[model samples]
Target chain A: MSAVRVWSKPARVVLVVAGVGLGACVLAFLGALFLHVAPANSVSKQYRAQVDWVVYPEFEQNWKLFAPDPLQRNVAVDARVQTVGPDGTVVTGEWRGLSAEDWAAIRHDPAPSHLDQNLLRRAWDFYESTHGEGDAQAAPGSRGQLAERYLERIALQRTGTGGGRVIQVQLRATVTAVAPPAWSREQVDTAPHVRELPWWPVQDADREGLS
Target chain B: MTTPAAVRAALPRLLTTLAPYQAAVVRIGTAGTWGAYLLREWGNRRVLYGDRSPWSAELNDRLLADTHAFTALSWSDGRWWFEAVYLLALLSAGAVALGWRTRASTVLFALTVLSLQNRNVFLGDGGDNLVHLMAIYLVFTRCGAVWSLDARRRARRPGRDPAEWGEPRALADALAAMLHNCAMLVIAVQVVLVYATAGWYKVQGARWQDGTAVFYPLELDYFTPWPELSGLLGGSLLVTFALTYGTVAMQVGFPFSLAARRLKNVLLAVMVVEHLAIALLLGLPFFSLAMVSADAVFLPTALLLRLGGLLAVQGRAAGWWVARRSGRTGGAAAGEPVEAVAGGPVEAAGEPVGGADG
Candidate 1:
């Protein structure tokens, strides 16, 4: 029996086209790979907060970007915190907006400013990473909490070098009740939906202003 | 007593009994190969290019600072090995695509794609995940027959009549067919759910029904492309009403439209336009891409073929006269070669029963 050659003129044309498609696929893959390896940022990506510590009751209702319905479009939660220096000095701060840009500085490198500005975001991120999302913010007695607290304790060691009197304080702002497109709510609300919770869940005593 | 008529009826039964499995083998093999190709391509990207690009650099920095960068896998070094499993799985998929040692390749492709997708659930877009999920189902069905090396070898094997295809075992075929059917169901249900939920939400507000909601997105400076397009659309109450009602009607009527090609095409076109508009107006590129790709899922096989044909045309082929002539009859009656059926069986299978058709 003779071997039936499947190749025809049209087939050759198809082969060339497919080859081009395959080449395009390769090019895209390479481009993606370059993006993966390059020392740039996921800036184009919208912000998705995986909070380890919410400091407020309303934060629970805040969108869980880590959850199944990640894009719930809730109120922005802007936060600032002040801490005492190793020598027991205090610091004060004002309520700064928590735009993604501000978070980017802290979330990018999280080391000294020279390394990258993503310090606070990186710390929270590290906590979430080391401890699972559920365990990262555990109560102090729990092993998860103990492990986390120790990590924080270690992290605090690097804070005092920045100032004569080092203090770490946080001011938190929680946006509330963002309305969704009437048609998009069900897709957005597969997770437990929160209806209009108070914006500031923290009482005056809970906040450290200047003292 | 088994009459001739009863025997004739039995032919269909026998054919169907075997055909389901055969069809599944075809689907799984092809899907696996395609999936593998996709996986290799995607895996290579994650491995080789994880850090150089702006997005990856930013993401890497964020993951590193967040301590989410490293994982337990061998490929977690932010290098080629970072998602080695995804790459290996993709390579397995390519082998499955080629129909070489198919049963093993198909199974590997399924598991590998599943694991890889599951591993980085957070970073995935809807299209990426949907493609993987669909691939799993496709691989279970045998898809490699026409385009694969396996078919070539099977044709040459003696005593294994080419008419009686040497496909995967019977049980594998059944399982694959079952998986494909289930995947179809899942995709349909997902679309229905999205529509129903959106419809229900629309009922919650007067604005949605009143057409105000249509203008809301456009009014937002980010989404209105040719601010003039938004103005034109918004100025007309009819357009807004149609847009709002159209979304609700599409969702509520999707289940009904499944069997009707005309309705499905109309609905799909609306969805594509809506997504395209969103992509232009809002900087939600990922969302637009995901939504548009998801919309693509509804496209029938014939349409995909047409698209392939259109794309195949080169610069000269795209001339106005060429396009008009090609567009006139839409290649339906074109005496094009049967080779366009890329995944069909070899000539041995294509031969007509009476041999007159060939």
Candidate 2:
């Protein structure tokens, strides 16, 4: 007299069918995840075409969780917006701190979400990894294009409305040197290096509501 | 009996026989872990997933479409709708944590997590992926079979034969049991894979090979929460090198060590200590907690029960002392025999009050 005996035959059938269906789904999902994270061997690549979609957005992950080497430099993202004045004069704003906002969000909080902790830094990393420090055009479908789009949205969100239509946007990464250990009396260069990108014309797609 | 149809019939029975109480433990661990994460990140929900995100709805929609990831956020058009979904996700997570209607709640919980994580995919780390996978797998497991409201409801049924409740052999019960066993195995394997990959990757890096990798992170401003402590630890090259190599060895040995019970227990203890250190030193408590919860699946049920027994014995002794101090006529409260409370076998004391299975 099992618990399943309490249910009618039809009910048992329905439960079994649903359970099998769910199990299949889980197996497929896990398979896709495995393929996505598997080492880049020929076998893995063969399955990539079939399972790439399953890996995207959700299951796609980077295993560099404090591995190899931890972040040695503290990088901050900064933005400057060029606006038109009432007299139709071009006005350049000061370097507004974008990463500072992230820091502020999590300053007093004990447990900050991964977004507050890594979003801005990863966004900058994304851009840097795709497009090096140069005025190279972002190739279509490349991660560079995606990174540009992501940064553009962040710049627009930070700038906000009410300011005269922003004509141009400039993004930069400020990398500060971390202090060396006391034992190592190494005189490492402590200067901050600023890598600035060319000002891109603000397109309608860059605007929040317009997009 | 050797035919395919007979094999199919036998498969369910095999699975039922093989099913252990481990799935219930994994369920509670995962549910508790994710529940805590949701609560911790509740205040920052807007920044991470809501309208306040730098990644706008249109951008999120495009990403979702391109990635073909399904999320409720894409369907949500307004701020209020998003907020409503977030609230529902929180409540559903609470329900799953309590193991109320666990099967349905597990499904809902996974969906909500997927929706939120997909909405802002960049706001995640390794722990998020583990949590995501575990939530989905838990849906296929018999998570509500033990230590759950559903279990209590089954026990309290009016007019049921008590013996029938102990060993359920029906088709649906067998299937559920099979699924639970399979899912628990998958979860254990998943954790092992994560560690193996992480360990192997570290072995390839020059800095890690040379043992200087740990020192660099401690020196970094981003990870140096306590500068004095980091400095003190990083000052010693021997200590840094030992820690670096020790971590690598433990992680690489974990999968193989699982075959030996004593070695596995020792490694598990070491791993827990390592994770605790990471949580405190690196300020990544949530991630560490998630990993530790996943690792808890390896703990043996017998060991957990013994620990529980020790605690019970201590509690009864304290109770006896309290009774003596009060100068009560009867040494035992409620007319219960003192020996019954003090000298009963662990099994005869009551139902097993522990979690996990080796």
Candidate 3:
């Protein structure tokens, strides 16, 4: 029934072995994938290590896309820098909307860049997920500090308003809840929540690409 | 009925290449998608993955060490090393889309995608995620067996068919076919899993259950790139409800729909339209493109071939030869009219469009 066939008996034996071996591997791969992607259960939790073994690095999949719940709040990220002059005088610059810049680049453009679309937004998410309310770290220890560094680097390049060498940078986010639709009777508080982060001094490594 | 003798007889059947048109189209769509993404982000390349990245080389290396991921860029942290890998990624993506030296280009394509993606995981959205998965999966598929430069080269050579060419070549082809068929199955199953997981997860949400989930995202300033359109859609109850519940129904029922050919075609069409709308309305062209391309594997083969033929005519008009004929290299008669999709003798009767396998 197959189009290509090896007539030799030895070769046929080899083909059978190869096919059967591959089929088992395929089954195993699928099983691991299922365990990795499926909603958490006892079976998946029990085999967590085994699943991660097969699914990590490559073949890692996350389809939680707007699932469980979509983002209900709009978080606008802002950054400001403190510059030190040659005479040692310093002035704090006005807050610049980093998220606003991304939105401005995105507005009305049929094809917005991945950089404009995701970089700032994901940076915020990464930072938010790693840190608890206020300054506490999330379950991922030390990652909060890493996220802060990543966020700090992002803030440094974005706020060019400070003029002189950037010695310190601070970030703040305003989260506004999305209003319920007209027809829906869902009562929702639309107050904006503001959280200002602590000032972090700029490291030499953070200023690498900045002039 | 399921005895060892029967299994032995059926084993060689694995040598048949499954859904060549589907595989080839998936390859083209994914490679073209990723290449276009690289080009669009060319200005942001430094900020996204190179030395200027917030997630610097040191940080990326630290993360990689923890994850134990395979990325060629991790081998060297020099600026030149980054630029070289970026150039190679762009070149290999183009080569893969063109189906030139597919065997090698696919590997290079995978390498570039993984390298660049792993460098800055934060730079990705759902689209980059899809491309990342596709890059790894495309490595295992003989996606260039049809509708590609490799296929054209084989067609021109005449004796390149495994049945005619003996020994190692034949053995290699057989092995490729076995792997390819398995890969195709895995891709289809993977897509199904994605939908199933997404749909089931959405069911747990109060917003999704009540059908107000779509409205929130559309109303979001971040997602509302097209303000006027999104505002109109978000304000309208009819459109919002339809989209919210419609998406859930579509995603939830997607796996079941595959069992029925007519229903499957309808669902596939709807999914493509939905993804396209997501692209325009949500300002996620790359993600939408990736999703649409991944869904292409389930598209009717005949429709894909027709699309290929149309593209060929368009290409010829523009004074370019765009690998017009498909399956010609896999033992289709050389004289077979190019008007048709130009497939091999295996599907002599043309096999009723999108039924069964779909």
Candidate 1 vs 2: which has more lDDT:
2
Question: What TM-score would chain A of each candidate receive against the reference chain A?
Answer: 0.28, 0.71, 0.91
Q: Is the docking of candidate 2 incorrect, acceptable, medium or high quality?
A: acceptable
Question: How much DockQ does model 2 earn?
Answer: 0.34
Model 2: clashing residue pairs? Answer: none
| DockQ of the candidate models in sequence | 0.04, 0.34, 0.60
For model 1, what is the alpha-carbon lDDT of residue B30?
38
- Regions of candidate 2 where Cα sits further than 4 Å from its true position: A1-38, A50-58, A100-109, A135-143, A159-165, A176-191, A203-211, B1-14, B17-21, B158-169, B306-358
Residue B312 displacement in candidate 3 (angstroms): 2.5
Candidate 1 has a DockQ of 0.04
All candidates' lDDT scores? 0.41, 0.69, 0.80
Ranking 1 against 3 by DockQ, winner: 3
Alpha-carbon shift of residue B116 in model 3 (angstroms): 0.4
Interface RMSD of each: 16.0, 4.9, 2.5
RMSD of each: 16.5, 7.0, 6.1
Q: Compared with the true structure, what per-residue lDDT tens digits does model 1 show for residues B1-358?
A: 9999887554322211122223323344335434533543453344223322112232333333443422233234344554466566657766765556665676676666554433333334333444454454444334443334455455455333323432333223323333333444443444444445445555555666655566565543223335556567666666767877776677557657878989888887877787666555433333445445444546665665444344334323344444466569684533232232332333324322111000
Top candidate by DockQ: 3
Docking class of 1: incorrect
> DockQ of candidate 3?
0.60
TM-score per prediction, in order, is: 0.47, 0.79, 0.90
Q: State the interface C-alpha RMSD of candidate 3.
A: 2.5
